[model samples]
Target chain A: MALFFRLEEAVSDLIHDGDSVAMEGFTHLIPFAAGHEIIRQRLRNLTLIRMTPDLIYDQLIGAGCARKLIFSWGGNPGVGSLHRLRDAVERGWPNPIEIEEHSHAAMANAYAAGASNLPCAVFRGYEGVDLAQLNPNIRTVTCPFTGERLACVPAIRPDVAVIHARRADREGNVLLEGIVGVQKEAVLSAKRSLVTVEEVVDNFGPRSPNAVILPKWTVSAISVVPGGARPSYAHGYYSRDNSFYVKWDEVSKSRESFLEWLRLEVTA
Target chain B: MSYTSSEMMTVAAARALRNDDVCFVGIGLPSAACNVARLTHAPDLTLIYESGTIATRPAILPLSIGDGELCETALTTVSVPEMFRYWLQGGRITLGFLGGAQIDRYGNLNSTVIGDYAKPKVRLPGAGGATEIASQCGRTFVVMQQSARTFVEKLDFLTTLGHGRTGRERRELGIRTAGPQLVVTDLCMLQPEQDTCEFIVTSLHPGVTREQVQQNTGWPVRFADTVAQTAGPTADELAVLRELNERTARAHRSDS
Candidate 1:
């Protein structure tokens, strides 16, 4: 059964040191609050996973909470570069985090494979591409029926998956409307899943046609954290704070300011 | 309203779109061009984002793929897998626009890194959906500001394979798309040589000289026999562009 817990308590109980954690959001509904809670709790050496890692992952890497990152794309969207992530990769400022990269299709498929309890995902990709040579995990498998060679990546069964959604019912049925990415697959693939919602409602009466509902049995825990996906938007709740992304470019440029802002805003 | 050459480039790019084309739009300038086309000429144009929003008709310019306006205004949304498998790989998208850190004379793009693969001096954002977009779309358009640095003789890494590798090689590799057809840059327009498949200067923007275009390109740029002056932005185009910008600002204000 899904249980409700306070933000800090949930983080303490669910996330541990050195866990492979997948925090997914396409562009909106990023679980910034949960990421902050993980940082505040001072967890260390976690392997963070996502498709397009943006502000929160940079914060986690800056805080030295991550040892590895499994991702498809990592950048501050619209902005140029993720300075903190660059610093970690180049100078090993806080710590040198290892990276295992994949394309968006491969990552999505790997998550699906994990959700389906499969060992690996076979897809048509990485043909004549250098990305395959760099990552050994992306190998080739010949189709038994057609004699076609396809790409294979191991299923990403993470220890924990965390995501933010628009709302959830008291019975723990989560409703994710608008631009649903691989969150559902990430949740089903993980051993434990934490969902931070904008609100906890008695019933998820109506939503947009594109909404995805994660039934109670699939979810491990739920926490109601308003403004959880700040900087990123929630549908019908608030708009994306575009200025924050521009501001983050300046904030994360140098080590001093990044840590200073981190202490004042996140850990504080 | 008087328009700058940059705006001219945007308008010209927008004008190239057909009425019913399904375009996979990139983040920045491509989004602007595609939206302008939708709002003005290409009313039935379908805008797809890699984030899975299909046929999105955003009132405002989306800052990112996950912008709320895109989700709110989309015809429908699907999962990432379905978007890639059913729409992209299934050959449903008609056009795609690409922007990258570096582009070669052959139209191959590099967005991965500025230096070596292992230890890059400048690590660019890795490919999101550009690889698939370039490979799968019926035709692709590249929009960027061209310079010696960007229009390089050789890409640092080939993130999206264009015509540089040749049609025969692409066919052997099972890449079916026609690759990049037109490259609309700040200064001029380029199309691939029919035989060699290298991008050649087709039309230079008004007031831009062939020497200037060649100087900006890193390689020895080839020009068409009859290089023509690209038409400047029309009065209607300028008006539409301005109205679009104003509406985007208004929408941003309303959202805030």
Candidate 2:
């Protein structure tokens, strides 16, 4: 009753060409390495959604794997520069990337609604802003009881959700010990889910019941990939290479250099 | 008299910040400056970030503004719109910390294009929430290394306008934000004159001459009649910053 595989194999089967995939992790933590490998396979026209896209997203976009992306910010880690995504937007490459400029929580709420089989969620956060003008997908719906106009964000049920965690068992019981945000909702909202962890235990005996971030029932495939959040530091595996990030920013300034760098760092 | 570029920038930023100011802090330089203020002077400063964190107080410097570190220690986390509309546009925010690819004399920023908007020679990172923050915040503090290429006479494209045309024109247009209040660089700190949008040297770091500041600027940089000496970072300030970085690196290492 347990499904297990390597990182690459797990992602290869979970993702398909043109599938809408939601990835967990922000900036540089717990990004699905197996999911990245799936992108390296040249899965074309794929739609990727994240709270914020970083180097991995840029690589996917550059590789022609991603046709569209939805996120709040896409850029080099610290410098707050997002040249790759900007160029694609300006040149109108890979079709116009639909941008949903909302907070990470708002996007998670939309996914939560989808997981709960709801049409939309009324959020009070976006009351008076031009974010409505940017997305156009979100609409104003009147609350039945209060008669107050609230922004109704549509559900986002991605075809696949790929997440990387600290530890897991053969049966896909995941333990994410630190900050737990929208990872649970992301797994539930997706039709199928893949979990890649730093280590795989024989069973879920070592972890306390409360420490389990995702239970086995929600996960379809599990992969044990040591150092899974490569380029991005795994929380306890290694310190983030600040020097590497600085170098990446310098190289990513130019389009040609960035493409070559990605091909080498990500694909190989 | 000696300070790292990051430390010097932080000192300049800390001095520029006012009490009860709401600041949209970018990562790196902005984070250092804001945290320094929190530690020393501006304890009531409200920090709003694009990551939806409000009034963040990280014990150490965050790896990035969007890192869970910010959210974990933040006083409150709201949706992105509330940060922009209610806090920013509603004029609750007083200052914005910005770093840019290029800046013009009028304080117009160019994070978008290098040549033209239609067919840009180099397409820079398109404006994120910076456009809104610059336009709506009560005042914006720009931090960049002083250089001719960055301090252009006119920007390739207006990614964020500090003053629509000029200080006079900005007033005429009824712009809400007071526009770019101060420009802090590694060499010196510059401020826009009251009636004109032209930047004048307000303070120079030790060993940085007025001529050096002017030479580095792209426009006809003016100097204040009485330019003051920029205070160097104290031993305590430098120690705290280094300790923060070391702790953050250690935390990441242990977690990995």
Candidate 3:
């Protein structure tokens, strides 16, 4: 069974230094509040993983929380580059960070493999692309029966998985709607999981067509955090603050402004 | 109708789409092109986003791939794993649409890094879905604003395969998807040569000279035997595109 706790308590209890953390959300239901809490706690040397490392990961990277980033794409969505991520990789602003890159198909399959308790993921990927040659994790496996060569990558089993969602019942069965990315597979792949939800309801009365429910037994803990996915937005709850995404381009341009953001918005 | 050259480029990209093409839309220019195609001529076009929104018809442009607008308007949404496995790799997409920072003569893309991968000048957002899209889709369309920097002689790193140094590389490797078949730039439309697999200028936009195309291209670009002048965007296309963009701008600005 999953227990409900405060955001800070959950972050403190679930995350620790040097942990391999996976905060998986596509663009919707990103756990911005939980990320800020992790930063506020000043965790370090963490291996952060996500497919698209958007603003939340950028903030964590800027605040010097991550020692490495494993991601497919690391941009500001429709906007441009993540300056903080660039600083860590290019200039090593707070600290030098290691990076492991993969394609979307490879990462998704790897996560699913992790969820299935498999050693590695196999798929037809990166046939002639140089990305497979560059990364050691991306290799080939020959089919014994058909004599076909397929691409394979190690599973992504993280130490902790964090995500935001629409609602969680009193029994701690979480409900996710709208653009559900790899959160379920990520949670299943991790050793422990923490979910931040818009509300904790008595029961999920009626569900949407594309609703995904993670049973309580699968989750470690939950936190009630309304508007937790601010700037990113939650489906059917609040509108996406698209302007903040646009404004973050300027705010995260320089280290000084990023620090100001930390002092005022994050740690304040 | 009077339109910016970029608007002409977008229209050209949209015009390339047929009613039956199931386009896997990327973020920026490709998104604009596919949406324009859906809003204008190719109303039956099936648009799939990386976030697993299949056949999404958004009224306003989404700032991110997983924006609620996309999910709300989509015919159905699936998990990311299913999207790549059953839909994309399963051969549902007919055309893969893309935009990138740099391109080679073979249409090979480099959106990963600008300089050395280890020690870089600028680190770009690495390939998201382009790699699989390039490999899985039946054909690919590239939309971009052209310049010598983007149309490079060599890429710093090849993130996705278009055609290898020798075009027979894919055939040799037993990969059969037709890679980046069409490229639409602000100045011209390029199609790969049947023999060389090198994209050569096939049609130039109105008032854009061959000298201009050659000057902007990094390589010694080749022109097709009968290079044609592309028709400018019609008033209806321009009006519809402008309305869509304006509504998008208003929504993002006001909602923020």
Candidate 4:
């Protein structure tokens, strides 16, 4: 059964030092509040994983929380670069965070493989690409059945997974609508999962076409944090704050500005 | 209508898509081009986003690939894994449209880093879906502004494959797709040479010179035997493109 807790309590209880964390969201329903809570609690040495590793990772990484980042893309979405993430990789401002990059296809397959209890994900990718030269993890395996060779990457089984959803039933079943990217697989692939919902509702009401429901038993805990996915909108709850993303380009430009912004954000 | 060279890039890229094309759209220039094609000539063109939004017809442009408008407007949305595995790798996408920071003569792209991968002067967003999109699609089209910086003699890193320089044919290397057949840029349209797979100027945008194209590309550029002048953007195309862009600006700006 899934338990309900406040955001802080859940972050403290679920996340720890040296844990591999995946805050999975494509460009929507990103759990910004939970990421901030992890920052506030000062969790350290995390192997953070995500497909995009957008703004939240920027914050977590800029705050000196991450030991390594396993990601495909690290940018500010429609905006340009994630300055803090760039700083960490290029100059090691906060720390020299190690990086293990993959393509989107590989990350998606890896997460699915983790959820399926598979050792590695096999796919037809990285053909004629130079990515395999840089990353040792991208290797090839021959299919015994067809004598065809395919690319393989180890499964991404994280220690903890966090996400923000549109709603959760009183029974703790979470509902995610619109741009539901690897959240379900991330949750299932993790040892523990925490979800922050916009509200706890009596009924899920009617769902649109692109909605997903995570039943109670699949989740470890639920935190009802209204507007938890702000800046990175929670579908029906709000719009993505495009201005904030534009502002982040400036705020994250310099180390001093990032720290000052972090101090304000953490204190608030 | 007097369209800017930047608009010419988008218009030229959009013209590449046919009515029956199932385009796997990238963000930025590719997105705008794909949407413009859909609204104008290729109304039946299917726009697939990496966010799992398949057959999306957004009223306005999406800043991010998976913006609310993309999902809500999509015919259907799958999980990211499914989107990549079934729709992409399963060989359903006919065209993969992309943009990049740097491109080489062989048509390989570099969006990863501007310097060494280990120690970078400038770090860029690594490969998202570009690798598979470039590899698995039936064909790929790259839309980026023409410049010496982007059209480089050598890439800092190759994030996606087009065609290997000499010995490594993408087909011979077990990649079945026609990788990066065309590159639509601000100044001219580049197509791969039949023998070398090196990008060569096939058509120059109106009022652009062969010398201008050579200056923009880093390599000692080559031109097609019969290099043709590109048709200017039609009045109707410009009107629709402008409307789409204006609506997108409104939606994005108002949200802030």
lDDT agreement with native, every candidate? 0.87, 0.70, 0.93, 0.91
Candidate 2 per-residue lDDT over residues B187-209, each given as its tens digit? 98888877777778889987788
Q: DockQ score for model 2, please?
A: 0.15
Interface RMSD, per-candidate values to 1 decimal: 1.7, 6.3, 0.8, 1.0
What is candidate 1's lDDT per residue for B1-256, written digit by digit as tens? Answer: 4668789889879988998899999998899999989988999999999889999998878878778888789998888877877888789999999899899887888888888877788878888888778888899999999899999987888888787455345667877779899999989999988888889999999889989998999999999998988988888888878887888766655553
- Among these predicted structures, which one has the highest DockQ? 3
Give the better candidate number (3 or 4) by lDDT. 3
Return the DockQ of model 1: 0.60
lDDT of 1 by residue, A1-268 (tens): 2488888988899999999999998888899999999999999999999988899899999999999999887889877788988888877879988989888878988999999999999877766666887889999899999998888999999999999999888888899778888999999999999999999888877666656889988888899999999988888888898778878999999999999999999887
Q: What does candidate 4's lDDT look like per residue over B1-256, in tens digits? A: 6899988899999999999999999999999999999998898999999999999999998989888898888998889999999999999999999999999887889999998889998999999999999988999999998899999998888898888655256878877788889999999998988878888899999999988888888989999999999999999889888999999888888886
lDDT of 2 at A96: 49
Question: How close is each model in CA RMSD to the real structure?
Answer: 1.7, 6.2, 1.1, 1.4
Indicate the fraction of true inter-chain contacts that candidate 4 also forms: 0.88
Q: lDDT order of candidates, best first?
A: 3, 4, 1, 2
Tell me the lDDT of candidate 2.
Answer: 0.70
Q: Candidate 1: which docking quality band?
A: medium
* Cα lDDT of model 2 by residue, A187-258, tens digit: 888999987778877775655555636778888888878777766655555445555555667677677888
Q: Model 3 over residues A113-162: C-alpha lDDT tens digits?
A: 99999999999888887778888999999999999999999999999999
Q: Work out how many backbone clashes candidate 2 has.
A: 6
**Docking level of model 4:** high
